[model samples]
Target: ADSLSCVRILRKMRERVSESISKMKADMSRAEEQARREYERERRHEYDSAAYLISMNKQSAEKSKAALPHLLTMSDHLGVDLLHLSGSALSTVFDMKEMSSLKS
Candidate 1:
């Protein structure tokens, strides 16, 4: 009867050990899943930030493109005005030289 009790005790110990191992495996699986979720969240945040920056850059480029024709038109007008002013100044100088020659 004592040997039979010892066998039963051994079987109960084995069962407890098996239960502990299963519980540990479940805990490890939960931890791994939590870690994977956190990693995916971080990656999603990074992707969103990058996408926003790209969108802003695209808008800035389009604004610059839109301004180019107006800037070119203003530049052309300034060039024509400068040439007209230069011609007027040259004509005044020539008239002054002619008057001085006639007085002499």
Candidate 2:
């Protein structure tokens, strides 16, 4: 009878150990899932930010290009021919001043 009780105790201990192991495994799986979800959310946010930046850069490039014709017209009105001033120091000076003023 004592041997039987010992056997039963051993079995109960094994059962408890098994239950603890299973609980630990479940906890680990839940932690992994949460980590995966958080990583995915961060990746999506980074992708969205990158896409927005790309779109903004494209828009800015288009705007800059579009303004070129107006700049050329203004230079013509000022009697400054780019072709004639292609290698002139005065032309470079004027161009720099114009660009600085435009930024301001």
Candidate 3:
């Protein structure tokens, strides 16, 4: 009878150990799942941020390209015309002085 009781006690102890092992495995799996989810979230955020920066750079490049022709036209019209006008004005002033000296 005593031996039978010992056998029953050992079986109970094994059953408790099995339950503890299952519980530990369940906890480890849950921790792994949580970690995976966190990593995915971080990766997704990085991808979104990189995509936004690339899109913004593309838009800025397009804006710069669109302004190229107008910038060139304006520089040609304003800058060249102003230089020409200044030269002509100086010539006219010098010619007037020469005419005055000849008259006097």
Candidate 2 residue runs with Cα over 4 Å from true position: 1-47, 80-104
TM-score of each: 0.31, 0.32, 0.32
What is the clash tally of candidate 3? Answer: 0
Task: Give candidate 3's TM-score.
Answer: 0.32
Please state the error at residue 57 of candidate 1 in Å.
Answer: 0.6
lDDT of 1 at 75: 33
Best by TM-score: 2
Query: Candidate 1 — which residues are off by over 4 angstroms?
Result: 1-47, 80-104
Per-residue lDDT tens digits for candidate 1, residues 36-92, read 465465566466766555554443344334333432343364332212233233223
Q: Against the unseen true structure, what C-alpha lDDT does each candidate score?
A: 0.40, 0.43, 0.40
Q: Give the C-alpha lDDT of model 1.
A: 0.40
Candidate 1, residue 64: the lDDT equals: 34
Model 2 TM-score on a 0 to 1 scale: 0.32
Mark the 10 consecutive residues where model 3 has the least summed lDDT. 95-104
